[model samples]
Target: MRDIYAGSTEVIVWLGESGPKDHLGEMILPMLTADEIASLYQWHGDRRDLPKLAAYVSKVVEDRRKTGSAQDSIDIFGAFYVLSALISGVEASGIQELRHLHKSGPILRGFDALMQPRWWSRAWVVQEVVVAQSVTIRYGKLSAPWKIFSQAASQYERARLEANADSTYPYLKEQSLARFSRMILEIETTRNDWNQAEPVGLLSLLRKFRSRSSSDERDKVFALLGLVRFWRINEKKIMPDYHIDAIKVSFETTKSLLASVGSLSVLAGTLRYSECCDSNPSWVIDWNYPPTTNEDTRLFNLPWYCAGGSDGLIELHKQRVLKIEASYLDEVISVGEELVETTITRMRPVIMDWTKLCAQFIDTRPSFEHAHYIGGGSVGDAFWRTICGNLEFVKMGVNTSNFATTTVKKGFRKATADGSLAFEQLRSADYSHRRTTSIIGGFWQESNQPDPEIARRNAFHHAVECACEGRRFFVTKTGYIGVGPRNMSVGDHAFIPHGSQVPFILRNADRLVACQGDQIETLSSATGSQPTYIPAGKHAKAPEQQKVCYEAHSELYFVIGDAYVHGVMNGEAVRLETQAFWKTTSICLI
Candidate 1:
């Protein structure tokens, strides 16, 4: 199907209430109606519609011109006439307005050449390479790169000279470009001063932009300042070895000399020590030991130094002090407690599931080797006891309900007062917290499981656990009932503790009755433990019977593989990514 306005050349025709075409003879009425022509100009944001309208106008103009009609009678044929007619029609139709016309304005303006048609016939972009060669002819012998650039420049000159006997270099009119080129010639001039201060080219560029008179130019100057600030803060972090490279002075050094010096010039002295500085030097508040009140002067590490005196340094210090004193001081004190609770909550299911599974695996191992590591003598029993204790706690809905609230309220003070040695170990002078220690103990024992293999398997297991907990694990009890809410029952869900009973009641079409409570005795294997069942009432509706929930088993676990390890021997060490015990399959039994 061909588009209505497919051709490169466009013609537009518009009809208003007072169109000139109303005077046309009845002979031409069958070929075109003014109403139909007006409807053709009605369109949305489309540029194609304009051309379609234009084509119809061109036909009318041709018809009038061939008839020897006066140019005044043919005003509809002019490009601007066609444009105004189309705009007015679109506005009248309520389909569009002039404000929406900007999108196609530039394209429409370019179409003025279309009236001639011949000039725009060829494709615009031609295949040609622009060869740019910059040469820095230092006062003495040029460096290899400079020499090569000079040679290329000379060759370009020779080729131009050959191309024309009478030649001129047009760029000579820009005297700054010539000055820039000559400066590149003096490379060796500042070779000795290169490392003594910041590069002059960078400084010069900053100065030029900083001193600009126009608002746009000043904006660019501020942008440069912001970039410098970013570089100063992040240089050590992003490129720790950047300062190691020696300065390579060349004739191009003059470009550095051209930059105007500002506040950044003061940074040159401090920059000397930046190579040894830390990227993120956190402030440590030793709450246990107050700052020596006896001392009049105290020296502390500041990430930035003052260019002037104590006032400048103190002002910067006060800004940070006020900021912390205003908001983060209390927040910092509070976050430790918050993090402690958050960590436990996040690790809850993981710890539960892992510990339980470790016990299960220990209980049902196919061979002695599987049992030897986690099993041995009391280890197996100790693990089983732990799992049972925890599982029963869950089935009984026994958790630190008020315990968490109390802990958070008490804050780190509890941990501090209780003498948790881990906190003190973290505070050891020999331990730099910046270099993180993954394992407080040492590396994982070489289980029959391959190192990477164990990690990959454990990751999949952990992901599954996280997914299940995210969706199904209940955070609150609403429909719960029991002797102190001992259990929860979803229909068909297995019960862990024996003795819990579920009672179901039907209440017409509008409501249902349910009751949950403890059982007289738990179903038990004389040798082990049994899962309990909650019976439904005989009067319960068939669908209502489905609402009866039995107590669910508490099954969650954690295996202890060392999470991090450091070595005192030979300064060598290994770390296991997962601190888990279960390997999932016999292939991971190693």
Candidate 2:
């Protein structure tokens, strides 16, 4: 199919009647220059280390800021002006000149509307469009190059992120257009990525398009098979077989990829990434679930650490039970509030509650000068980083990205470094104000800084919010501070699989497999963690606090997705090399 499509002269994509293709000529093109449109697309995905390209893009934006061309202003503000004139009951002729300014709003809501077409999301459409020799998108009678829609979607997203600085409309920015920008740009990027003529692995394709729209559940894997260049050796192993069940296809595909690639990376795809995650094995990647991960964010593509230690043994028994060597870190002893949503109202309370939770384990003074933890960082530094999952936003397109970990956590770090002000401030009569304002005020207050830092701050805030949005703050039995999945519990554990880059949270699969027909398997490698395996049909009468409760759980655990433990993040856990403290052992996962 790919070869045939590539040989074709041209592919004319009909993007329905209301998509960006229809509005490209009259609306989007009028507002943005060719360079700006290209720049929008370039910034659509992850930040590649392209110094020359990034510099060129910076120049274009600077030029636009310096010279907002007459047409640009008219195109931007003309729609609102034209609408107001009509509301005032002006003559139609008087409004005629400014009426065309209707195109001006394309930078805002108009562009969002243009991205509304369903064609951009169709999973089956990818191979045809991407493999084609040349492509154009048409809507109704209007036709435009595919580049117009592909690139335009990213600009609206960039604008949406920048607009959050308007505190009044911060909620509005969160609610609208930003998601559409993400969707279209992802679709566009995959298409462009395939055009590079590189042979992509099947695992990459599965992760990349996991959230894409597909009418048939099986199409999620089948549709991407043509693009899997690395799977030719095992091509017969994973061919499209519609006769098979969708869940079976998904389950088999996971095994096939792991077998072919010979890596444990796919373990990261389970639990959080799987949809209908209930019935399937905790280790399998269900295609139905939208793996809504931000690849460009903190968890991935950052300064990676090998906290998983050295790879040892990886075996799949009956191609069902996932047995691998993982360094067992700590069981979650206490669970803090789960940050359920990404709203301005919820963010403050969640962070505050988390801070209080940290306070239980360590000190947070009025001046916040304390450090008693695993990694040797100050108390304040550990608290803030753990809450945000140890993430900072860099390369956020128009939003500045140079805000370093040292720079971001320094003010809070300073509070930890010096206890001189702490005692005096506590003794002062105005200690109440000093206590409250010194910590949260310094961290959370909205800054009206100069433009660039404001964008950087907004981006930073967004990174923290998004990173912790659906996760809960957790304290390990060993006094480690971190954040895990929303559904994580007190007995759930955090570990680093030998081959994985980040730590993952997992819960005992005892009750999880009780409902399913899976057999209980004890998975441990010399840790004296030989907990009694209670069959799925049986019950453990002990409560969570009791040893026989979930705490004395077996090695077989269900994944709760990736996590950020402050001490373990930078590989100190691996460095310690003490089995009793943190053991590198084999554990079973569903």
- lDDT of each residue in 444-470, candidate 1, tens digit only: 111121233222222222222222221
lDDT for predicted candidate 1 compared with the true structure: 0.20
By TM-score, the best candidate is 2
lDDT value, residue 463 of candidate 1: 24
Query: For candidate 2, lDDT tens digit of each residue in 1-590?
Result: 87888889998877565433222222233346565555332221222313322332254542552354333232212222222333343422233321222222233453344445776666777787777877776545444455544554544444434333434334433343456556656656667667775656666677666767888989998888777654433222467798998878877787665544333545553344432355567777777776544532333332344555434344554445666777788888888977765554446666777767877765445544465665675666676656544544443343324445644431122112223232222122221222222213112223322344344445445556656766778888767788777777888888877655568888776532121323322222222121232221223122211111122224677777777778776666666657576667767667
Model 2 TM-score, all chains together: 0.66
Lowest lDDT 10-residue stretch of candidate 1: 326-335
Worst 10 residues of 2 by lDDT: 540-549
lDDT of 2: 0.53
Taking all chains together, each candidate's TM-score versus the true structure is 0.12, 0.66
Total residue pair clashes for candidate 2:
3
How high is the lDDT of residue 526 in model 2? 22
